[model samples]
Target: MNRLTLCAAALAATALGAPALARAEDGRWQIKLLGSGVLPDGRIDGVKTDLIGLPAGSRTRADDNVVPTMAIEFYATPNLSIETICCLTQHKVDGAGALAGARIVDHVLILPATLTLKYHVDAGPIRPYVGLGPSLFVIMGEKPGATAKALGASRVTMSNELGLVLQGGVDIPVGDGGLGINFDAKKYFVDTIARFTTTAGVKALETRHKLDPWVISGGVYFSF
Candidate 1:
């Protein structure tokens, strides 16, 4: 099965069984396993330099990815916590419009690392939260795609960037136990500059990109 289907099934099953293992929440730490959707809006912001002539109406888009993630949270008080997640997400950028059906970059692996300070409140049995944080999109690896190679691009590199993230979510306690279902969403504001080096060892092209991704997740959390 695909990753999304697998994750959804796991989430549903665990949530359904949460009540049986539920206990009172008296611990300061919580751990979670979540299925996440990495939806990115990767579009060209500007072409700073281009040795190869790009067609008019040239545009780019990034395909989305789904992956499993683990989160750790430490609650210092009843209403405050520090949270972070561990995961790696990968995506590809493809040409659009005039360069339709062409791949520009591939295997762009990223570690979207974040550290947030969260505020929580209770609405009956539901714990709702909001968070703000700084984020770093670490470019673990990337390379030129087939189309880029055809255009004489021999190397590709993207800059790692710092950005801000806003988060919101809710947790539903199924019983007295700390077992619960969690749903969360985070919005990121980030930008990166891409450089393409040709076989002649010259920087042939450079462009700026905006990759503001919306990270949506659903899963189960254990408080202890």
Candidate 2:
């Protein structure tokens, strides 16, 4: 089976045998295993370039990715907690407007780490929570695509990003243990700069990209 299927099956089995797992109490720790699909609503702006044949008004955009994710939570009280979430995701950059049908950058990996302070409602078997925090986005492993090479571009790099994160979710208890399912949604406001190098005697291209992505995820949570 694929990774998503396997994860879902494992969660199902865990829930079926929840009586054997440890329960959640005050000041307890919870860890989660999640499979997520990341959809980015990104836009590229301030695209200043001097490539010979490309238009000065050319624009860019980014594509989505699906990956596995993880999170950890520490409950300071029955209704309050601190949580950290992380994921390693890959994205592709494409040309837009005047540079349509061209691939500007490929196989770029982004690592986003987020920490939030959450307040949960004590609603017996079902708990709802809201959180707000900061995220650190690390951009790396960027490779120049065909369009870049055709324009004599040799290397590409993206600057590290910092953003704000807003989150909301619900948790439902399974059986008698603290094993349950958590469904979450998060919004991020991130901005970064991309630099591209050209041939030995040519100047580089620098552009700004804004990534305001909404991340939705569901997973199995174990508390102790």
Candidate 3:
């Protein structure tokens, strides 16, 4: 079985043994599918426009791209949990005004996985929690067009990313052991080490890009 399934089984076994686990479901595992949105930023390094008499516009856009995410969380204690999310992301790059036709779409798979420790506060039927953790992220994509002259026919590439994460959430219990609803928000301090190449004998293009985005998600949680 997968790690999530294993976690769930462990939680179930623990719940059967301890009254705290049975009542609070302290070690339960949670899974969620989150609809997410990505904010993209751009930067061009090591290339000077005005100094080299070149008119290169290296500006980032504030376009929000929607993506889908899958997550698995495990509660070590009733008040503490750790989670990971995977987002399938795609970005469109427009080559300024004159070179608008030279646009490209980059398909990125982003995994913002975190290992957080949370502290929950009980408030009647509502539970609120806050967490801080370390995160690792990976970003990868394919070349916009394989036969494009500029890209030189590079098909696919990948990046290694690392970051920190901060998160908070609230849970609204429906009925006794029936179902629960959850709402959470997270922010990732992500940085990517990107390396790519093209078929035009270009070996490698390496750069480190940084970005931070806030994510909001809601889902249902069922406890037995």
Clashing pairs in 3: none
Q: Model 3 Cα displacement at 141 (Å)?
A: 3.3
Using Cα atoms with residue i matched to residue i, what is each candidate's TM-score against the true structure? 0.86, 0.84, 0.67
- Lowest lDDT sum, 10 consecutive residues, model 2, at 13-22
Error of 3 at 85 (Å): 3.1
Instruction: Please give the lDDT score for candidate 3.
Output: 0.56
lDDT of each: 0.83, 0.79, 0.56
Q: Model 1 off-target regions past 4 Å?
A: 1-27
lDDT of 3 by residue, 142-192 (tens): 454322335543644545666788888888888887477888888877755
Indicate the residue-level lDDT of 145 in model 2.
87
RMSD values for the candidates in order, in angstroms, are: 7.3, 6.9, 6.5
C-alpha lDDT (0 to 100) for residue 160 of candidate 1: 98
Clashing pairs in model 2, backbone N/Cα/C closer than 3 A: none
